[model samples]
Target: MSEALEQVAKNKDDVAANEAALEDLFCVISSYNPDFERDLITRAYAYSKSHHKGTLRKSGEDFISHPLGTARICADLMLDSVTIAAALLHDVVEDTPSTIPEVKKLFGDEVAELVDGLTKLQKVSLKSEEEEQAENLRKMIVAMARDIRVILIKLADRTHNMRTICHLDKHKQIQKAKETLEIYAPLAHRLGIYSIKWELEDLAFAALHPRKYSELQQMVSQRRTDRESYVAMAALQLEKELNNVGIQVKIEGRAKHFYSIYTKMVRKGKEFNEIYDLTAMRVLVDTVKDCYGALGIIHSIWKPMPGRFKDYIAMPKFNMYRSLHTTVIGPQGKPLEIQIRTQKMHQTAEFGIAAHWLYKEKGSSAKSKEQAADKLAWLRQMMEWQSETDDPKEFMKTLRIDLFEEEVFVFTPKGEVISLASGSTPIDFAYAVHTDVGHHCVGAKVNNRIVPLHHTLHSGDFIEVLTSKSSHGPSRDWLNFVQTSRARNKIRQWFKKERRQDSEHIGREQLQEALRRKGLASQKIVASPEFSELTRSMGFLKTEDLYVSLGTGKTSAQQVVTRITRDMDSVPDLA
Candidate 1:
């Protein structure tokens, strides 16, 4: 066949495959949302296919499959039609000659905004990988603050990419896997999407640590055959007991993901055989009442281990996870783990914030919006911290801390539950309450007993931050013990604001000395409007910023004077 004819035939085949994929995606959407707008989604799919027609992924599959995969993930999450459409078109504005305005004109503002949010800053001239990453995250966060669906789409896109990542070179694969493990997986966990989170972790773990992943996979496979009969017997016993109590239940055994198993091994310094809860049995009931009833029935069957019973149903996790977890001695005298929850709670536990869409009705968008706001309060707090943080490295550092830290649920004196990072001191707690409260904090008492400022906090500790009218401000020592970015950023901002005047004074003197050494008219240049213009041209908001930069030794006196000599049209007479 002629080359042109072969190329045309390939395009035709790609289109036919993409159409089949679209049908599968639509079926997923209709399974949950029968009333979804098929026209809108079809248009988006066709548009994406048209734009990305000739392109191909590293795996040699047509590029349209990538968007189709991403959109399917979103549909599986039971996301709205607009979100699924945005997922399809996310890379169009970025990779193709298509523009945002064109998307907006065709799809409306909502879909356009979401696509734009997922688009990276490919055109910007970033100085470093860190800067580019930080800026890209900054853009996504801004869009997320406006609409949380932007992040949902981004997560779906990332999940799809991670699925096909093996097609790339080994170095590229490892790099992408590390990034997924460090950022995207944790973000999914925070958002409470365990389905995606578990997949991302396992995929990244496999890519980054192939040998360990293989060994773990082999271990899990070998153990599965041995444990099948044990799990079946346990399920039968639980089924009989639950039936006797007149509560309907579904029971299944779930294996721990490879990365989670890896984390447990490293954290406890134990081998796989030493891990008791390699597989856990989940009990799903029809109602909350049945959830507790099943828990009782399970406890009656086996003795639950102390310090292993967690009642998350009463006190749900920040990520909206609700369940009754217990570790018990099961048949044959081996330790068995069990989680009991209602079907609705299971949905929330599995899907996190995305489950909100599954339960949403037409007129309840206002309530859903309110629920999303409450669920994503941490995202807003992150935005505030990032805005105050100027350094790209600092932003990424603080972001990782926020994303990775395990939560400790503390309380205020008034009994309001306040969540902070584990190992957080009273300083972090005070800052979490309010910035002013943090600044004016004089002392702290945990559970009505006075504790030192650097004392680490734990769950259920009632924190009382005592403030005095005559208090000076936050101590510099607090930064050493503080675990939250908010506390650290606030402390740094305080010092910077307090030292600005001194820095400006020192900076002015340095510039004058430099000019005198060069035999220029120092006083005349200092007083001239030309100097202010030069400061503005140097990317400073005002003359004082340039002075402060010089005073802080961030910009040397020689560099500033040299720029001034070169930029100025007229030079002052030599002294």
Candidate 2:
């Protein structure tokens, strides 16, 4: 047997002794799956173990345990065998000498590609860590173009890593944990992966401020018994009432996550006691009509807090999450949040993309496919956006600003729901709806009020963008006001095509500023290989053509700077 395989066997025996209950739990969960595909999973596990054989995690456990645990989590999500396999081997490429080719030979191309997508690039001497992070994000987006499952597996791997972060040093813990909060957690939330999102946020918060985490944990623990009693009483009453109406619904109550509660405290300046909706109940019904029926029944039993109700069923979230949410004053005049949704919505809310496998297991392949397509649309959009720009820093910045920012939902004239970033203006909305509408947008009417084109859209606002037949296209200033990258890119494309002189002028000014920052003045940069290579990579046939395109306002100043700096290593040192 390989040394790594022997080590893993020994580690398994140790775990069986030290964490017997957890081992039993894992076995029970694994046993429940009739189609475990044990051979594929076992081989992948052995490969990971071999790659990380002699290494011990900061937690003092064998490094292989982390990947094994991550794979188990993916299994719990009911992901495919390939996804579970990929999860098991995710860290091998980055953490060990194992290459993508080796992984492909061991597993298959699909698994290798998934691992490559999840792998972080090797450190280079040329870039700062922040620049490296931006570049890594850019590479991940490029990889995402191939298959989205890579991202899903990466998220699961990150979630598991964050969960066990307490084993690392304080500095490393805080760094990794904050990254989880700032990036991975938000990404998961965007993908509707609430289970991963909540865990990531909580663990990150714990690592960043252990004192605060502990205090909050203690405070919540003290109220646990009372909270359970109150929830039980409420559930009993709700069940009795719904049962009387012959409404078959399953109701359960849960306390808000610590990080969620902390965010409310920080953002709204509220005390822990002042957060009224700490404990909430969710009702899952069999059908859409039953969901509404359950909501009506719940509201009949308690008075709802005005303006605290939202009907997401009519206008679902961008991630396709649907539910009827209401904050109500219960029996003791205490506020409680109630969520009503169909069983399918419940599964989607809990498992997100993984719920597709759940449906497949139940022989609902059509529904599974639809859900997968809906979830994968964001991946396709990311790929599309990446194709429009070659500057990795700018691409990363635009993606972070567009995808991870807060979102607001608006409606078209036909009542089709459109979601944009929270501060997004009507111009952004116009571009999101259609590039043509945005290009010729003359004015906007938001909820029948004649508002400026720059008016920020709010949730539930019925937006109508006025367009002119005369192709008086998008204003240059609209790019500054627009929140989404899609709108910005389209506007740039329009200028690139129609206003060469203006684009060239803007591009020249941008390129000059970038050159100055890099200590290469206009005269020096004109002959520099860096400048020539940048333009070439940007698809310009000639250096002069590139300069003229920039001078004409066809592209962004930021994009010019990014490309130059990224290729700085190849440039002759002006210094």
Candidate 3:
């Protein structure tokens, strides 16, 4: 037993020394940013180590090791000293007796705020274990709205947790796996952090569907040799083809991960043998011109599959992802997927948000900050959706709808590209353009042809929304077709303001008829001071609000009458 314990400790030390020593983290960050504050990092490490000493995780490893590992990941992103400090101190407030105030005192205000935002997530109260998996999702989103660093820290924390999930019990493992799939993985994808996003997915899939995961893993393993050989042969041919065109390029082959293959299998309802593009050939070039040149060459080499091409370089994703993709016939008669991008784009593809920190050229840091702010503008949009309803569950429902969608890129009349969630309609497009445009929109033309408001937009379609000053406002029917929460919220807001008077008029008529049926006078009820109280009891601040609810089918006049009768019955003979 003693010998085994010594061996385990020795192995742990060896692994850490080789790959993730404290000095390695320092050296990596210094290489990226020559002006970084190494002294501050060392102090943060000592402070976090002191606070977390003597604690042990479920794996029986020292708890301080978790913070150290998280900080190491932050260093890998080439983050600043403050973010790395926050990563080390993130769990102290939630786990230890220390408070946010102490973190502020010890680490300053910025790091303290991040730690506070993280600790707030530990207090989520959900409906049930099964139904409320995304209960804390809204809270994290709201926190992200305040500071994008909050989520970056939290995502790093979650990555470490998921990496060590094997230490947890089976029941807890399933719970965490579901949470990661439903929330963190999608969040990472939205942030364009594919480095952690793909790993989180595979880890969760392994835990949640152990048998299926093992089966797919074995399948991938069995095909490793054949796929490598095929990819090698294809790379050589592609390199020669590009070289003849004088477009200097580097070719690499990437095997698809198990989770992606499984997703393709289920999404397309195909077996492994039927799945095409098991391995993607990525071509890196020097310039944007060379990217398109390579694409044309790849197509000329192999017969291009119809509708299997996407030009993301021309129209980058909202998260700033860019690549040119095409599927074509290759050796072994297999459909090969090829991606072409510049070297800068390839870095962005791999590191995503971290790419901004990886280079320290002049003006790059400022540009990166501006880009980070732009990317997190979606957090403000999520907050806009949250403003409509207080129910975290409902917010999460809409959030999931937005999160799981594949992107669709459409164009404006002027040729500017507008990216939206897949399945978005003309109304969603109009709203995405502007709230005022959506409100006054009377009709739309897609590709110079008139289409209904509910017309689902396909990629590459140019959309023109026809507006009229005489148009009253958005119709309630638009809700039935609008897909994005941004569009849905804007439409609901228009009705909530514009239709309140209409709702009140309709509600008053409905109330009068109900009063007559109950043999009570409507005039008397409105004249009484108790009317506002009656509306308040029904969860409305004013009678007009009650009427608006009635008009929207959210409440009925009959229910109001029943409440009135109960109130009257409670009164004594003074009535």
Best by lDDT: 1
lDDT of 3 by residue, 1-575 (tens): 69999968865774465345668778887887877767766777777767776677897667777887787777776677777777888888878788888778877777788788888877555567533445566677778666666777777888889899999999999988988998888888887778878888999999999899999999889988888888899999989998998999999888687788999999999998888688688899999999999888888878898989988888887667899999998887788898999988977776666665564433454565566767665667887787675555666778888777787889999999888889999999999999999999999999999999999999999999999999989998998888998998888777666668887788888887888777777777865777778888878888788887887778888888888878753322213
Mark the regions of model 3 whose C-alpha exceeds 4 Å error after superposition: 1-20, 126-135, 359-369, 470-472, 498-575
Q: Which has the better TM-score: candidate 1, or candidate 2?
A: 1
Residue 459 error, candidate 3, Å: 1.7
lDDT of predicted model 2: 0.77
Question: Following a full C-alpha superposition, what root-mean-square deviation does model 3 have from the true structure?
Answer: 5.3
- The residue pairs that clash in candidate 2, if any, are 502-552, 503-551, 503-552, 503-553, 504-551, 504-552, 504-553, 505-551, 505-552, 507-550
> So what's the TM-score on candidate 2?
0.81
Per-residue accuracy of model 1 over 186-205 as CA lDDT, tens digit each: 88998899999999999999
Residues 79-171, model 2: lDDT tens digits:
766777888898998899999999999888767877887775334444566666666666666654555566777787788788787777888
Sorting all predicted structures by lDDT, with the top scorer first, yields: 1, 3, 2
TM-score of each: 0.88, 0.81, 0.83
For all the candidates, what are their Cα RMSDs to the real structure? 4.2, 8.6, 5.3
Q: Indicate the TM-score of model 3.
A: 0.83
